[model samples]
Each structure stands twice: as C-alpha cells, then as structure tokens.
Target: MAVAPSTAARSIELPAALADWLATHADALDTSPALASEVVPRLAGAGLFGAGVPEALGGSGGDVRDAIEAIAAVAERSLTAAFVFWGHRTFIEYVLQSPNQALRERWLAPLLQGEIGGATGLSNAMKFLSGIESLQITATPLASEQGGWRLDGGLAWITNLRKEGFIAAAAVTSSEGAPPAVIAFRSDAGGTERSADLDLMALRGSNTAAVKLDGVHIGEADVITHDARAWLPAVRPAFLGMQCGMSIGLARASLGAAHRLCTVTRSGLLGRVESLQAELARAVGQMHEGVADGRFKSAAAPLFRLRISLADIVQQAVMLELQGSGGRAYLMNHDRNFARRWREAAFIPIVTPSLTQLQMELQKQAAAAGAA
Candidate 1:
C-alpha cells in the first residue's frame, strides 16, 4: 500500500510577521554575510529557535517533526535562515539527549534563547558513525589532579559558528583506544579557532566555517556521551530527520510555483506536478512515521533512503518550476526567487550524509548481506 502522509504529524507554523520578514529579506540573507550572521538572533526573537524541544528544557514543547516543519516554513522563505536553524536545533537535540544533566542544565536555556549559537560540528562524526570516516579530533587525558582532556584536531566545514558567540559539539577519540567521546565546548574557549566564512555559490551568509581545536580543554561537564558509537545511533534519526526539512521546504516551494504556473498558463505540466507532489507526500509521511514511532532509531537504512528521495524530488521540483515559469524565472528579478531555489537545490545533494554518501552506505549494507 502507498503510505499516506502521517496523520500523527504535528504542524509548526512560523509567525506571520516573521514569515513576512523572511520573505522580504531572503535575498539579502543569502547574499549579505552580515545579514546572514544575524539570522540566529532573529529566529530567537521570533520565538522559533526551540520549536522541537521539550518545554522543560526552555523550549516550546514539540517533537523533532515539529522542528522539521518549522525549518521547512522558514526554508520556503529563506533557505539560508533554515540552514542556521538546523545547525542550532540539532545541537539542542544533542544536549537534550546527553546523559549529563549538568551539561543540559547549564546550556539549554541560553541555547534555546539564542543567546549562544549552537554549531553542530558533527558531519564528520556522522560519517565516522557510519564507518565511512574516522573521528577528526584527538583527545589526551590530563593528569589526575587536573581533570579533563585536551583536544586537537579540526573540522573541514561546520555551520552556525556565529561571531557573537557559539558552542560546538564534536566527537574525539583518544590515543589510548578508548571509545570516541562526544563533547561540547564554547567557540570562545582557549585554543579553539574558527575560520572566516567559506565562500559558496549560495547560502554564503550561513556562517559556515572550519574549526581547529588546539589543546582545547573539555571537562567532564562538557561530555555529551562517553560512548559515541552507541549514543550516535540513538540520535542519528533526529539529526537526519531535521536535515530533511531543508529539502522538504525547498521542494514544496518549487512545486508550488510549478503548479501555480501550470494552472495560470493552462500548461500540460500540471500532471507532472501532481505526480511529484504525491511522491513528496509519501516521502514526508514515511519520515514522519519513522521519527515518531522510533523506527528510524533502530534502523536508519529507511531514513537514508528517504533523505536520498527528498534530495532527488527537490531537484526535480526546482526544474519543474523553472520550466513552468519560462522566461520570467530566467530573468534576474529583484526577488531572485527561481534563481535562489535553483542554487539551493544544488546544495541538497552535497549536504552532509549527502546523497552520494547515503548511496554508498546502502551499497555497503547490500554487499555485507550478500557476503554473509
């Protein structure tokens, strides 16, 4: 049976005022670095930085699906802002799921309030989790009297490394061969350095940067999980599920444009639009069900498939929008609507746990089973 959109899904609506603001400034946010860096505080002011978190943690009290919906709503206006939202919210999830109550209690309020940016510098960690890569950072235990570990390593690319202030999470392996540990530390911590923003074809204003840790001290309070191998699987669902929001929002916007153009122009493309929309609904429904029922937690292959499907659907949606709109969308209008989304769709495939990475993982799983 064709799975339907999850009836159990809860919708998260961005405030009309904030939506209007994003729509008006989406271009500037994408093009202007300064404007993009300010997106975190703006989202906090709109009371959306904590949409998916529990109320007890100073959040608005919804699940990860609500978080995904919130991101999609912002993405429909400005993907740059939504990218920032994902990084920040994903970090919040890490802290919320951490076994360390002290860490959660210390950081949740400020993070939820957007007082400090949350950089989920975990793309490499996720790859590491999948056995595709090893942990990037190394940890050395300090003397017994001076507790904590000194970390040295770097992340090639991470988002939400804000200038004002931020906290970042990373997985570090010790030379002693102990299991990798997931830890959080402030961006301003000594020996921690953030590079200038990376120049990109789009979303340049996303505050994306490389981070280097040189003898950075991480205390017991900073540890999210002592066993990254075990903990990562538990949180992987939320991480990937939230990332899918970007694809969802971008796809919906492009498809909506295509559908509208087909209607107004009496174009035959409406049938194709409807077909893609149905596929999109199925992907979303599956994601919703997986996240809610804990299916994605124990088995991530389906989630990976869903992520791949969404990326493909997003690209097709953008192409359909471009075709339906004809010459008008090709023009460099002030809004740059079609042009921006086209660039945004290009990003979907390359995002962490990218389509290529996920495909390889599926292949590995298949090969292992065949060998067995």
Candidate 2:
C-alpha cells in the first residue's frame, strides 16, 4: 500500500525553550562554523527539522505557513543556519511524499530526526536552454553486479553538499527510445562525488558545491519522484515557503538596524530613521498576512516579490543607518546588519529561476489571465 501524506496536529505556539535557544544561539550560528554545527543538531533535536513534514511521519504536521513562520524566526537570528535548515526541510518534505517506501524509511526518517543531512543535486544538472538543451544529466542502466542504474553527468551548482548524507537530484534516464526520469541518490553510494566548494557571494555557510555522478548506481528505491512534471508543483511551493522566511529575516534585520541607529544617533536624523522603520513594519505585516492566508500560491509569488523589494529595502535601510550613525555603523568590527542581509537577499533572486525569470513568468501569467 502507498503511504499517505502526513496529517498530524499542528503546533502553532512557539515553545519557550525553542525561543530561548534562538535568542542565545542566533549570533553564534551566523559567525561561527562550530556554532552552526552545534546548532543544526539542536534544531533537529527540537523537532524543527520536521516542521514541514506530515505528522504521521514524525513531523509537527504543520502547513507551509507554519514552516515559513518558524524559519523566519530562525533566520531573524541566523540567516546562514536558517538557509541551510530551510533547504534541508524542503528536500525532506519531498522525500516523505515520494512513492518509494524504502527510500522514505532509509533517508527521509533519519534526515528529519537529524541523524543525517541531505542536499539537492538537481540544480547542477539544470540547463536554461529554451527547449531541448534544458536537461544536462542522464541516467543509464548499469550492467555490473552493483545492480540498479548508473547516473552520468553533473549538476552546475548544488547546496549543502559537504554536509549532506544524501542528494536529491534530477537525471534524464533514457537511451534512444525511452523517456527521461528524475532520480535521487545517497551521497555515500558508489559513483557519486562532490566537487570543491564554490566561492559564493552570500550564504557562505551553505557549503554549496558542484556534484558529479559518473555511472553512479541507483535503484527504484532511489527515485524520489519518477515523474518530474508532477513533482514540480510540490517542490516549487516548498521552495517558495523558504523564500518567504528569507524575506522576513532580511526585513527584520534591516528594521532592527534602523531602530538601533535611531536610538544611538543625534535627534536630527531620528525622523528619517523612524520613517524607514515604519515602511519596514508595513512590509513585514504584509508578508505575515500573505503567508497566513495562503495567498500568493503558498507564499511563492509573494516571497519572490518580497525578495525583489527586500533587496532594495535593505540597501536603503543600510544607507540610512550609516548616515544617521555616521562612521560608527561602518566600523569593521561592528555588526553590519543591513550589509549582511542585503547580500543574502541578493542570492534569493538569482539562485534558480532568477528574478528576471520570475517577473517574465508573472507577466505571462497576467497576460494569460486577461485573455481568459
């Protein structure tokens, strides 16, 4: 029998221990790799890893909105940790709903419990070609004793490869006569290798890298979703939920910086700082409403829109904070709230579909709706 999607009770209230943990360790997760390692395990222990999973599968059984809120709270403290956790949770959710039962028991369960880390290998094999050039990786059946199939190709940019125990990747499986399929694989499995870490502009702690699978053996158990087209709809929404958390984190940091400047600076700049704070408040309120209502298609559209807006808001807020506080805000040792968040926000729009692509999609959607 096929496993049903989780439907456990949702825990909306934030536990006191979790709140205190975020407050105490947020800064550490940002600046210290050791602290991140420490915190990630704790987060998993606290059941935060299962926030987006179904209750039947040992998750909190919450909706995407709850996951967004929890991630936003985490990001407010540590964007790096939050980003990693968000990506991990998104992939874990994908595995939980996958058709492969053995894969779910071996990979998804352990991952949610924080026993293993997982990364996505799909982005590496993705090509933006308008038509036929879109897919870059292929999976071919292997003839050797290892059994299953072999994946031969690479993904362009993959995140969290260094730490993950398994990889969820997409590969075209075909010869001359068969249709292509997307597949998932374990990191320790034969034929899988991760390249050196990429020099990223933001989310440095993500350990993003390129992954190559050279005739790596895989079986039916490794396939998360055999039908790529059917999987896209679910994956897109989960990613959008994470982006919503990222925007909330960026906005919160920006606003916090503005508040700090207002409190420390001379009276002359207080009015401008206050205005920026109010604008940020409005933006955050809108974000909250958007997530809560399930509007923007489970927060994907709003998150994408907020990503564009957050980048601008963070930049402007930083400028205003520096102007209000003079050179103090620029001190290398001082926390550069706006600077870090602005840089992080930059990654959100460019990571996959990209801002330009999202805008064009929105425009096309509008045009299609008008015709309807």
Per lDDT, the best of the predicted structures is 1
- Per TM-score, the best of the predicted structures is 1
RMSD of each: 3.1, 5.4
TM-score to native of every candidate shown: 0.96, 0.78
What would you estimate as the lDDT of candidate 2?
Answer: 0.62
- Worst-scoring 10-residue span by lDDT in model 2: 1-10
Count of backbone clashes, every candidate in sequence: 0, 4
Worst lDDT run of 10 residues, candidate 1, spans 1-10
- The sequence of per-residue lDDT tens digits that candidate 2 reaches over residues 1-372 is 111133422223445676577656555444444443454566677777777567787777656656766676677666776777776776776676677788888777777766666665544232221122467677777677766676787776766564546465565646543555667776787777877666665565565677777877788888776666545554555565565576566556656766666777656667776776677666655655654455654335565566566555655765665675567666757765545655665565675656666676567667877999
lDDT of 1: 0.88
Q: Tens digits of per-residue lDDT for model 1 on 1-372?
A: 011133556565677778888888887778778686578888988878677677677777668888888888789889999999999999999999999999998998898788999989889999998889989999999987879999999999999899988999999999788899999978888999999899877898789999999989889999999999999999999999989999999999999989998999838899999999999989998988899889988888899999999999998999899889887886786238888888888999999998999999999988998999
lDDT of 2 at 368: 74
